[model samples]
Target chain A: MTAGATDKAGISWLPGRQAGLALLLAPALVYYFVVLFLPQLEIATASLMAADGRFPVDTNFRRFVTDPFFLSILWRTVRLSVISTLLAVIVAYPIAIYLSQPWRRWRAVVAFAVITPIMISAVARSYGWVIILGPAGLLNQAITGLHLGTDPQHLLYTETGLVIALTHLHLPFMVLPITAALQQIDPSILRASRILGAGSMRTFWRVTLPLTLPGITAGATIVFCLNGSSFVTPALIGGARIPMMSFLIYQQGLDVRDWNFASAVAIVLLLSTSTIVIAHLIWSGRRQRRAAGAA
Target chain B: MSLPLTSQVFLEVEDLALSYGKSAFGLAGASFSARKGEVIALLGPSGCGKTTLLNLIAGFLVPDHGSIRVAGRSLRGVPPHRRDMAMVFQNYALFPHLSVEKNVAFGLEAHQVPRQEREPRIADALAMVGLSDSRTRYPRQLSGGQQQRVALARAMVVRPSILLLDEPLSNLDTLLRKSMREEIRQILDRTGITAVLVTHDQEEALVVADRILLMSNGKIEQIGTPEEIYERPRTEFGARFMAVENIMAGSVCSGDTAGTTVNTAIGQFKCTPCDVVTGANIKIAVRPERMHIVAATSGSQSYENRVTGRVVRSTYHGTYRRLLIAVHGMELIVHAPVSSDDSEYSGDVQLTWRPADTHVLLQ
Candidate 1:
């Protein structure tokens, strides 16, 4: 009797399953093609064209690779993004640990403060940093007033300014993931470590840090990719003095009207960022496999 | 000042007290001691400060007004790691990222034991727990009993002066718990390391511990050997906790060479001699298994104490049958061994017990 009922149910379900799945998947497929694939294909095709809009195989690519000016900008972008990610990780780790404590009366307040910048527009946040780090800004005024330095420092249009702004923008991304990982750790594990004769530092190094590496990897990948491709913060804070890959792409596309060069630079930026993220994923995946196999 | 040459007690806790904010559910002046190589089980119900006392001794929590001493040395201001004690957590908090070998080697690494010495010790510890073949497996891959054994091996590898266990067998199934109870007893005997175990299961305590420290409401109700704590309870809570089902309030009528007679709602009962004045009110307890059921037609049988009642309920419990009898407005439970003639007895039934079986709780 059960077999007959199951066969009847299977017969009724089989006919509609294909049509039902296609109907459910239609919107996502359409959105992906229209929003992502079509524009990317256009950019790829345009990147291969010469300056005269004729089909040339390697003109723009060769120019981008050989030009020392563009090479320095690309290197600077990658270096600054790496630095900003490291700074964000260093600053966010302790805050994540504090926020993951069992006591929760003040965690909500600190978490709101950490996430408040993401709610505001990036342009507005960059302008706020401008007021803070500019000459005769609040910091300079304090420095001059305290006689710590004879002259006001020029921090407004430098790579240091860009890194500081980018780090501030991506700090929350680093903190939230690490905090989630920290919270997943059982409190008994920490207590067990202590009872087994590990001091606080040794316990964290031996147990807590290894357990939370997945979260750190996720947060670092996101922050690195986001900061690498960011254009708004650099344009507003670093001005024309610091030349990042994103700013170069923006200049070629809009200021000089060099569409081919702009597309080439954009492709380069996408490839480099994806390379870092993919490499990290591969390394962490191998580590996880090794750990599982050892166990 | 001269120090004592030899100290008899291995671990001593004096006048420990703690309070949880405004709540009264915290340890209040609990004191106990353990000799070297003794296994003491802190047996109590939930919210009775057994775990809290364990935490206090482990340095996870500080006592508000007390001091702990190990081997005549005061343990004030000593952190958990520096105190040289090990613990087996209830959930067996093995490091999920590490293999079993690394988990057992963690304490040795903490103490800066050299790698050359650590490998052999780890191997021996794993072999002692009978998990030498599974040392490379993660804790998640092992069974519950295997994980518990790993936890035990990890604690023992450090060779600490004392070991603490927090509800170690409560996480296992009934049959596994019984076997693990015997395993823990054997391990403690072999190691001869002073240990303190926390458990709420009376049967587990009875099987595993050398001495039982029964607690109630953050206070030590009684402390004695397992046989003593089971056969003779000093307080009503201790009696009830030991599964003594029948308790009757009565006043002492008289004392003679035979025994002391107490008059109760279920008629007079002759109990073992206790230091109680005549006409003083007292309470007495009898275990359910001690009460024997006989046929109502057995007339004038010579029994120290006898009562007749109707069998209200009878339950077949495989090896034994439990019968609830209504006796003089009070219900009494009787556990009888199941035999071939184990048929339901209706109507009147007589329950008999020796005078020595009645335990008098003075408090």
Candidate 2:
């Protein structure tokens, strides 16, 4: 008799839960449908149109695949994205580790300094980078002062300058995630490792690094995706000499009025970012499953 | 593996003091010594600095003053890995990422012990804890009690000069705690490794410790064998901590060589003098089990200390009946074992005990 009552009691809260979930998620669902899904559907339909504006045609995609200009632009986009992500990871890991230290009481200040670029408008920050990387800017001044370059070095409007600027712009997004992951590690585990006969460096490699891999993966994926789609930094700094995919898309749609081709390139960029993110999620999920099985 | 008889102390913690922030004395001026094969339990209440002392011994926390020495060599500057002592934390700090065998072998690997010897040592330690069948299991796969045994085996596999346990059973439930306490005791006793355990559970300490150091407020209250501590507590804290209840204020009324009669609210009682002169203020302590309850209307018997009182309340505990008697404006608790028919008299009961049942407190 009590079992029957308990079964009914357990099932009684389903309606309330449904109501609560709808109340909480309605706004986000509406916004996603209107802003993200509608635009994505429109882009998918427009990517199939030809230059003559016929429906269900593959000319836009054919032109993109055959043209060496678009192919080189896509390749440069991926290369720059990979390089920037690597640079961010290498430069930010140490800073994140230092920020995650228990005795680092000024961690908030350091974190604010690392993320300050994100608070400024991306255009303004990229303009600032343009000033620093230009021939008459900070780099050339330092080089001339050290007598390494004559008069001024043409450091600006180059791939190197673009990568340096992108790395600086996306460094905080990388560090924030990694630092959060590093902070979740219990201090007692490290102490226990030391007591179990591991030195500090060994403990860091064996315990701390493995536990923070998820954070590293998240930060890398974010930085890569953002740097891959970046427009303002490369367009303003590299000028006409360098043609990143986003800058090319802007030129195709706005300047040349080739909306179909621009939409196709946009879809390709979205697919690439999605593919990388999905692969990462699957890899981490499998790793988690293996850890659970081992445990 | 035999050393000389006078090879000096195995581990000594001297005058150590520590604090977190401005909180005074997590541990203060604490000192103790352990020989090669003894178990000393640092028994105390929570926040009384027992875990801090263990952390200091494990080299996890550096003391603000004094020194820690192992084998007469000062270890004040030595790091935790170099201290060569294994610690079993309260939460059973087993590496969740490693299997039980791997956890046991970690110390050996860190010390660069030969790969051939490592497997055998790990296997032997696992078997010692009766966990050979579960050697491949991770800590998350095992029950809490089993995980603790794995932690024990891991600590023992290292064969350090000293082993430290910081409230290792506090996390377990009551029945598991009792069984695991026995398992821990057997393991420590079989190895005969010098060990120090910190626990707030007095019962756990009494059951497992060869010698119990009772502490309170950053100082050692008393230190003795469990039996000595229970029967002859030196301080009020020790007396109360050991659960010797039944305190009453009394002054000497009649004096003799063997015993003295003291006038108290519960009437005149004969007690052994606890270093007190006649006619001095004294506190008398008697365990609840020592007092017997009789009907207040019963025929007078020749009991040395008998007080007539009404039974205010009675509780039927399974083993015995605990009665609260109102005598001379104070409650006297008397425990009556259920077996004896003479112990069944309930309301308005006359409590009685002989001179030796009462332990007189001078201070």
Candidate 3:
């Protein structure tokens, strides 16, 4: 204690020791508050504000609560997100399963091919979809060429077209998570299951699917969130008539200059997306806990 | 038409040969048969193709040039699950996700055994392995011995045509391995199921197997009861594998038919010409435990062979003193029993044995 006191005696004049720690972390703290937490808080406050640009004394949540137009917009966003997420999951699962197999050389090649669409610009990818979705597009031409249809199909600028675009855009998000999850499973577990009298199909159903649920949940959440906020791909491929939430938010804030209304819509969309992500995470967590408990 | 229990051949593998590729040979001309209610152990060192032989019988592998027939039906293209056989792996290989009960019940479910029948079978199998108390425990929760018991329960629960155990006890510690070996033997006997086991440990094979199949360099060196493989080894490789000492290279010096006397460097020794011919290059094999140290110069009895050697080193290993004797530039390991009454031959001991103890192996 005497030696420590003697050493501290000379260094006692040192200033900003506590301040230095805060100074070191100030940038990250400020960035987190300003970029993330503060924006969310501001949006929440702005959503509760009246048309006068001041937060309402009463609950102006009534605007979003009472308007059927806003309710329909919300429904459309959720409906599109659900459909697109479902499609993405359905298409991505088998591809992820194939990629997760033991063929490393071919896995690399096939994985690259599956994800090659992601390498192209999203705009360019949507345009390629346009070429396929157009009446004179390659898909219709192929259908006519094959004599599978009597006429060029009416495939473009609809909810179906938007769903198709959203699915294509978010397919990688689904496959990547599922693939990662599937890869973590022990190969020996499968072999053991097979030896223990399980047929291949039964083993997959009883073991593989349940073990990879976390990944499926993660992939679905990503695809859903992306589909919910989707603007460019839908606008380019689905046309302005579809009017997803992102397109409406953009129209109100930038094109129509209705900042308060746009902020309210943005806040609602953000809350919906966060709620879905959190709910999925919670469900997956509960399932994993139960599995662990059983094991 | 089923043969009587004692006369029935449960599984037969005739001339089984396996090779992975064009040049690499796995097992060559391996042939053996197991009878009902008997446990046959395949005893060999690593890479001696013991596991390959077990795999062949278990239907996990197909032989390139022979056949496996269980219950007189050729399992040429039968998948492992379809072969009506179960195996206990060296690693245990119990399903990690399944509880002990479920692991045992897996085969029942696979065979589509009615749910009402499966529960009791699972319970009985688990109880047989003394794992009833831990039936609900996962594999990771059990000890190594417990896991092995679970694996045994899983294999036995199936009540398959035959059981294949691929070095199942090799993963256990010495004391546990000994106890589990007895436990498994008792279980298999109680079930009256024909079983095939592969192990590299001589003691384990001797203790457990009704008959031991000795393999060497991808071939069946010898196949016989433990006593035959040990006391009456037919090949030099077989004798060496069983801890038999004093393998000597020599030529037959005597042609008369009572026996052939080989003029070996250790000294000229009389050997029973059981398999070797006179005037032929041969190797003589003898067990170290069979050799006795006698008062060579003072003995009233006349022995067939006697060797004078200096004990280079003597190590007392609790039950016996393993002596390394240098006799005419060759080292012979002799296992001499420890006794307080017997005079200890520490250095420069005279070793002698009867001619019948010597088995001649033709090179």
Name the fnat for model 3.
0.21
Clashing residue pairs in candidate 1, if any?
A: none
- Scoring only the A-chain of each prediction against the true A-chain gives TM-scores of 0.90, 0.89, 0.83
lDDT of 2 by residue, B199-236 (tens): 98888888888778888887877777777777767667
Give TM per candidate: 0.94, 0.87, 0.86
B194 Cα displacement, candidate 1 (Å): 0.6
Tell me the tens digit of each residue's lDDT in model 1 across A17-111.
Answer: 57767887999999999999999989999999888878957888889999998998899999999999999999999999989996878899999
> Residue A78 deviation, candidate 2, in Å?
2.5
In TM-score terms, which candidate is top? 1
Q: For model 1, what is the error of residue A260's alpha carbon versus the real structure, in angstroms, after optimal superposition?
A: 0.5
Which pairs, if any, clash in model 2? Answer: none
**Of the candidates numbered 1 and 3, which has the greater TM-score value?**
1
Model 3 TM-score (B-chain only):
0.92
Show pairs that collide, candidate 3.
none
Better of 1 and 3 by DockQ: 1
Q: Model 1, stretches more than 4 Å misplaced?
A: A1-26, A293-295, B1-7, B256-259, B296-302
